[model samples]
Target: MDHSIRLQIEEREAASLAPYATLSRETKGRFRPEEECPIRGAFQRDRDRIIHCKSFRRLKHKTQVFLAPTGDHYRTRLTHVLEVSQIARTISVALRLNGHLTEAIALGHDLGHTPFGHAGEAVLDELYPQGFRHYDQSLRVVNILEKKGEGLNLTVEVLDGIAKHSKGRREILPEDLSELPATMEGRVVRIADIIAYVNHDLDDAVRAGILSESQIPSHLQKLFGPTHSGRIGAMVHDLVVQTLKNGGEILAMTPNLLEGIAELRSFLYENVYETNRVHDDFIKAKKVLRELYEYFINKDDHWEKVIDYDETTPREQMVCDFIAGMTDRYALDLYTNIFLPKPWSVM
Candidate 1:
């Protein structure tokens, strides 16, 4: 059934696209298929592929704010991906965009992230002179990491958005604002990540008793609003409103909103991320990750077991895939068993 021609396909049509978990539109080029494009639903299949991949499963044990196993309430990468999906879909629906495609982009955005948060990413970047980035890793994850050694073969637009979603990259937008569904649907989710983390991390910080709402800088506190949900709503609403107001295109955040977000982020950095407990764990993760990288990179035999590619393949990517696939506990155990001195037994 062709989905492009329906005059606002009902909820059932959207739901029907769910079963074929790894198919894509036959559309050519890297462009997102318009409502008039050829072929069937591609976005839904991409979403399903990501949902079933090993990397997606590993997200459950990766950190969003706090370390894994700290407590149930703290957000893991899986939960974070779900939240971003929800938020992106909501915005997509309100604007009559391709919600499923937006959702696929959001769901797979974090697949390449390290076991710890930015700390782990920083360690890897330092270890590899050529550098490592989760965004590129995400593309590699979906396109080459899964599927019995084959990638999901997702749509080009989806891949482009995933690769360039980082703040430092160029913005996504249509050549003319007249186009519907817009080009930056992926970009929307990029900013949405910061929004999700800023508000949720604050909520977690308050819950963990590290900081209070009253302690938030007054200039930004009013924007923080009376409740966590309220603050997040305001942020999301502001972003959508701003983007739409710019003729349905995403714009760089205003200095004020950017500053406010930075302040809130700074608060999290000082009170939550930089605390001795969290930093200690992050350091341990770095040590483990570095050792694991070196071990696998140096020992061709071990690398062969975990990584299928040849030595001709880039060493950095081999190490990345090995580390990116690790569960938090698995990483820790590997590090302890390999690097730490073990007590002698009488056996």
Candidate 2:
């Protein structure tokens, strides 16, 4: 009887993966110990857990670039993560790294982003006395809030990837090892995330008519090419070629292409992200989240009706977690029910 399918995979990894690859059998282990699965490796289990989690399902309704976009094709937070998974896996396989770990990180990376995109995050940041960041909140979600507070019990490697994957307009790959993911797989997700967003956001901007294909800076258009797939292909090709050239000891990219990608990101911020057409709705989104935060934090009697609470946890923290977990339409619908006037007919 083949009782240990997992052992075969682990053995294959040792035989096939790059020397730098993080092996599933060598995981740092989960927060809580679990019985070894008969069939799957650690990272494989992690990927399955994230895909089935409630927060992962909520991503479909969460904002990406556009808040409550009326169009069907606009990228939602769900779509963004899927794209990142594809790009990261592609790079991981090319480098002979741990593709399972890469997929797990990519899928779970944005699980804690607030509804209504950054506008909602901004509201929570201001409203929470300790302040908020989606990356930190993501860790909090997996550790304390998921599975009705049992938490996900994910591997420490996956947890580290989720925590450190955020770039936030900073260096895409920081020089400080402290600022980078503990594994090369995590770093791949970081770069893939930016590549997914910068390219897709630009595509959405054009699709939304916020700008035209011609309005983009000519140098960027030439470098990335005119099509969406072409641009992502160009970016991924450069990264793979350069990283392999560096002996896989470090993830590397040519300075010229790196700077070119950076310029393309800057161009989007100037031409699409900040323009009145896009910025105006986010301003309104902030207001919705702000009102919701205030209503929950200040009105304790009413809050008890909605949030299941224990006296030990701070109310503000509970409220912040509750808000950040919401999907875009769910936030709006809740706000309307709580704050908007309902038509009344006297009987």
Candidate 3:
């Protein structure tokens, strides 16, 4: 009811959080400074902003692993972000870190991902001059694309976490911490991203009949767990226990646990992602995005109609933004509308 609730929350955080936890009150602040909210702390405000933004909403139709999966239970990008948020918050709460910041970062981390998952991403990278990384596009979304070029103006901490969240094929906890987010809460989200995807993607793969439970190496099954829930629980528990044991100095996984996850990831790549079962869809998705990219880039009138802001932005960058913002259905529809022949109608 009171406007000063933010201060009360800040006080509670200062008293309860670990020394390493990022304090919302002391955020590096937004790119464009403004008056503090009456009731919301900075990170809380950021979380709310991301939840309400357009890009966040578009995540529902974006691909996590499968392209246009007919199965209702498959994990879409939105579900993936929610799961990442849930897992990251759990770890943050367990470690006495900043949960709100972690959630904000987790939710916003994939806002820039292209439709049709990494296949669309690969096509964009190949076509664009400077190349496209969804992490950077996500930062661009929050900083320049959302709010019609006004941007989200989120705090530097949120921006940093979103920017650095991608681990690609790299190790979960690299020796080089410099490239990781500066805050421990941010780092928590980074590791949580990996945990969420590896487990869930495998689950989706199994559900799609792409892989069977027995196909997962027995050693890995033993190391992580026999079930999806069991593996996630094991990974989350290990991360929280390790971080707390180290006094929140570093967000970590036991070397054995890390190796188990890494091995599982390799298995997914070799068996599911690279196999023709997935690649057929991936190849089609790539062609769809590639054709769309070329059409928008070469057709000036169509490009002008699609992009409505800032004439000075590079054509390639604008094309990337347009494509990256599209959902799986939207991309398919646009491609069909532009390329497919419609039935003739008599007046």
Say which prediction, candidate 1 or candidate 2, comes out ahead on TM-score.
Answer: 2
List pairs with backbone clashes in candidate 1. Answer: none
How close is every model to the real structure, measured as TM-score?
Answer: 0.81, 0.97, 0.97
- Each prediction's RMSD over C-alphas, in Å, is 5.9, 1.6, 1.5
Q: What tens-digit string does per-residue lDDT give for candidate 2 at 126-234? A: 8899999999988987887888778889999999999998988888767787888999999999999999999999999999998899998888879879899999999
Candidate 1 TM-score to native: 0.81
Query: Per-residue lDDT tens digits of candidate 1, residues 227-332?
Result: 8777777776766677566665344445577667777777788888889877887887788788888887787553433337765778777777778767677788
Candidate 2 local Cα displacement, residue 140, angstroms: 1.0
Task: Identify the runs in model 1 with alpha carbons over 4 angstroms from their true place.
Answer: 1-40, 168-182, 251-258, 303-307, 341-347
Candidate 3 colliding pairs: none
lDDT of 3 by residue, 213-316 (tens): 99999999999879999999999999888877877788777889989889888998999899998999999999999999899888857443333666677888
Clashes of 1: 0
Task: Tell me how candidate 2 scores on lDDT.
Answer: 0.90
Model 3: lDDT of residue 102: 95
